[model samples]
Target chain A: MKTICIMCPVGCSLNVYEKNGEVIVEGNSCPRGEAYGKTEFVNPSRVVTTTKRSGAFSYSLKTDKPVPKTMIFKVMEKIKKTPLKELDVGDVFIKNILKTGANIIVTGKLTI
Target chain B: MSSFYDVIVIGGGPSGMQAAIEAKKEGAKVLILECNDSLGGILNQCIHNGFGLRQFKEELTGPEFAYKQYSEVKKLKIPSVFGAYVTKIEGEKITALVRGKEKEYFSKAIVLATGARERTAGEIKLAGDRGAGIYTAGTAQKMINYYGKLSGKRVVILGSGDIGLIMARRMTLEGAKVLKILEIMPSSSGLRRNIRQCVEDFEIPLEFSHTVTRVVGRERVKGVYYAEVDENLKPKLETEKFLECDCLLLSVGLIPENTLLSEVEKNIKKQIIVNEFRQTSIKNLFISGNSLHIHDLADNASEEGAIAGRSAALFARGALEELGEEYEISFSSAISYTVPQRVSGCGSFKIFFRAKQNFLRKKIVVRCEGEEIASKFCVGITSGEMQEIEVESGKVKGPLTVSIE
Candidate 1:
């Protein structure tokens, strides 16, 4: 498994190899890199955004923070229930929606 | 006649001072031409904390941060002429024309660090009269913090940028009543922490998606008409409303000072374009700081100044190669723009970019010819705070594309 650690400006190339149900990683200089690799490889999570049926049009809603590396697909299911109002870019959906108490923020502008 | 040095730096602001210091460290004699009587640029007027957090690891006010750099210049003993306005720079030798009360000087390698100017109310074409109460946020800050004069008793800030927000808090602390902060965009353009501290903590009402449509007053500002924007950012008719305020502060934006560049007039579109090395089209000329482009923070400007300074020194030593034509820089994905459009492919390079908007745990993948070369993720990136990615030599081979995802 391999991933890029988006911790800061020093984007180190990260490579993760697994053996005997265990993972070993190399090439990252930061502790965040190691944590990202292990979490991403084991349960891959991401912040997700989707549109919900609103009164006039679609309302784009998203989790305020990153979720379990594996729950990205399931969270999208939950987000489909909330209709996104005509929100501008960078609007917060929730302070902490991950349930784990981590904050996920919006990444793009709402075109509609 | 004007005298010449190896490098001539314009503007004695932090960027200009730092550039001169860096050039001196590289064994190059440098001259800094400052237009003001003092060396500190905007920092002299900005007396707030939240500076020197990244650079010094300790928080300091703007003036204190500037004094540290000023002391470094003194230690290095870099030569500079204060109260000197650089009128122009010309030719292969990079002769610069500057005027002072008594004398003028010319130099070899010219560096434009003229900094930037605040965008006035007239430029934005806001429907209003030339009232006495309207002022740019920076001007208001200078008046209050530098001259100890209050422009108005009550204020309605028209922009939510760092300066405006800080002014809001400053005014609140000074016993002035803040009517509201009208921001056109939905999100504050200032740092997140600033929004928390200045607006949220101070109990200032920050109205997003709102803009001032017209100003109402003849002799002085009596009120301002504002409204919320629709999905297309058109002011919603139903949302129109008027608020009473004596002062209107425009924190809209800042424009780079490029009048001197036009005197010598080189190939440029919006601003004087430079390559990754911070070198301009002319061989012996360089530009950095606000003169090159607007940066969010002062520390970033200092870093750019260092790069331009060091590169100018290399050019003076005659060890620098002609910046190659093969490697060009392009911005895509989530980047607003990248400085130094081309890297000479000769040395380690630093690339600076501003995100189009905020990001959440996204990776910035640097690609060459559609192949991934380097990628890094940021916990979050914003348009206000620039993100700098340094690429060592050999990692980049061809043209580069940065995508944030």
Candidate 2:
């Protein structure tokens, strides 16, 4: 399978395939790209970034770590239903959300 | 408050904050004036990760990168006034309205870090009635990421810029059905990583060589008439089709906001022309960041701001010296405009530009006086991303021309 590495803006085109009981990855400029190719070929995950509303203010939040790609909408559904209170930037809104081992933390400031 | 300073930086975005930090490091009294109440500017609403890679050597989200810089400015004790709308810039004097009252400030040197604005629907001359559901990509981003409000239930994005692609995913994640992304060009103009992670990840349809010929709605967008275009970018009447979309988002392009410098200088591209030091034609007036030229990354803007800040401080201290004769940096037709339109006395300086088209394993060569000064082989260079090349300055006798082969 051919895919583009999203590790950075470089976006190295990577070729990931299984051959003879071994997985092979090629066309990466860096080791991170190679890792991304391998992981993506196996089980894909992504760090989701979005906003959560509390009162009249909205604060940008993101998963503290990458979660399984298949469970993205489920995580988003949890984020939408989760009620947020007065919080500052860097504050955690949800802990280990959906057993994904990723906490939802605020990335934006709360402006009234 | 003292009405005078050694240096005054306008716009407290990433570039403005970096400029203020660098100026303060030079032991110059610097003040930052921001129109918004916060310092982050657009980075506040950009919740995505991928920033701070070049600057901090770590992948950080926009807000994370912004807060890091803002903390530095705070640590330096650089005084900044938010909600200060600058009205005029006459020489080294700046007039702004702070809390509805006009205030004047004087400085020996000034750095204009005012950023860029998005191209609107009217700017692109979209055939549409005055609608309520149309928004620029940045505006939609601000609404979704800042206000946590979805713009529409069904979205149709025009132009394949990075913002449009990011919004496509954001809207989808928010439960909005992004019908499709239409690009007038034959290929996507956004970064390949964005195309992979944002659009392709969600299985969103991206149609190239297609564009909305007319907007079909009143009061609020209900749908749009789109068609495939030929090589000349002319829409084929026979290929016209309609798509049901409640909202249309445009991610066309950005124009540098240099309205304050209208009396000082003018460029058809709306970008401020500056030298290697980021100094404009007017002495002691420096410009950086998007006001000078659109930068693909915030890290480059901060780097440019640092140069401009240092130069502004030196100019304020009356220690800046002339750097010999200036030579225009020319480029071939295959290349787009080069920043620092002119170069003056440099040991080794970087020139940033964009290619007109995609090229793989091409050589970017810089020549001065018919002598090849520098050349580097680039891999998979695309017009979507900006490219920078370093040139070792010699006693330049003629125009420096940069070409790709």
Candidate 3:
């Protein structure tokens, strides 16, 4: 698989070849790219955003935690359980909601 | 018929919103005129994180940051006219040519928060067919962030600025293959945090001292050629190569949006030359945000915006005094340009600028009337970080010069 390294401003064109589920990378100009290539092919994580309900108004608790790339769908599911009663904007909803120990702060608010 | 208002804000971005909130705190009736369909000027479309770190003391996305300010503006009963396009601002009057399909209205003190627009591909001529695949990084980001549209499967981003670096990561996350980011300079122009969070973390290749010599494409985009540059920025031979690609995203730079201000004052290279209070050469009318000066972060813009707001209020109240003679800050070792080429007779002020290059340890000195008044040391200072120094406004009585040691 071919990818671009997003480590520095130098978006290096990287070549990743996976054999036996092990990732080998090349064409990267720095060591950071090697680590990114390994994690990208193995486990991908991302910072996710979504909304939580509380009464008629919906409060958004956008997570600042970088969750596993595979768990984005499941994390969204778990986020649905938390209600936004009395929640305000910029309010951190779940402290480590995904058990990633990454604090998720409220990013948006939907009100009438 | 004309309605009297205590304060009127033009834009709804973080700065404009903050200015409106501040002005309203003075117990004055405030109104915000937003040209866009909704509030939040550029912040509405900027879907990435890295905002409100200093002001809110927490990392917030652009929309999230905008939402916090919007909620305040909404709760404070800060009336806003959405889809209200402002046309002119002269003296104490502002003319906004508004139209919502046959309905037209005029409103009058304009904040002039109309933010700057991105310089398009047409301005920077890249050798190749001006095709569909070419786009500014901001445009591509709007497509993906708002409309959920992918620019292309393969891409080559030019200019190692923040937007380009962030888009490199964004495109990769969306399953698009980013070929590389070619920068004309020896070092990247983006922030260190962005370089770490967006580029380095994502394993994106950032080629320094390299530039796109030629772009190869017929209708869409086929590929691009890169080459190294010398000290004078002349393209060096024997270092040219081609990569296959379908898209080219240019994150060149932003020019201040000063179309309406043009009728009042002339432009010096497309930037409105303003006084200490951010008042353009013309009196009463003020410019802030990206319109006054291109800032590194929204934080600086907000700070300047609030000052402009206060100054506008003071002007409206006829409390403004004549500006003193201009004082210039000269760079010697590694200092870049400083704003407010002339300092007014104020008490306390902070100067903002960037370093010429990277340095481990350095001393910055401020000299006025051939006497050094302020001296400070720094650590790990790089061109990536904008340097802001606060000095007692009373320290410098006459013209001053700044030098780095």
Q: What share of the true interface contacts does candidate 3 keep?
A: 0.09
Residues B207-322, model 3: lDDT tens digits: 98888877788788888888999999877868988888999999888887777776665444455655566666666676678776677777778878777677766666666655
**Window of ten residues with lowest summed lDDT in model 3 chain B:** B101-110
- Write candidate 3's Cα lDDT for A4-106 as tens digits: 6645433566788888877899977768779877776777555665444565554445567567865665666676555545766667777887687666676
TM-score to native of every candidate shown? 0.75, 0.97, 0.79
Candidate with more favorable, higher DockQ: 1 or 3: 3
- Model 1 residue B302 CA deviation in Å: 0.5
DockQ of 1: 0.02
* Regions of model 2 farther than 4 Å from truth: B266-270, B393-398
- How many clashes does the backbone of model 2 have? 0
In model 1 chain A, which range of ten residues has the least summed lDDT? A103-112
Task: Please give the distance, in angstroms, between residue B95's alpha carbon in candidate 1 and its true position after superposition.
Answer: 7.9
Interface RMSD of each: 19.1, 1.1, 7.0
Taken over the whole model, the C-alpha lDDT of each candidate is: 0.72, 0.89, 0.71
lDDT for B388 (candidate 2): 89
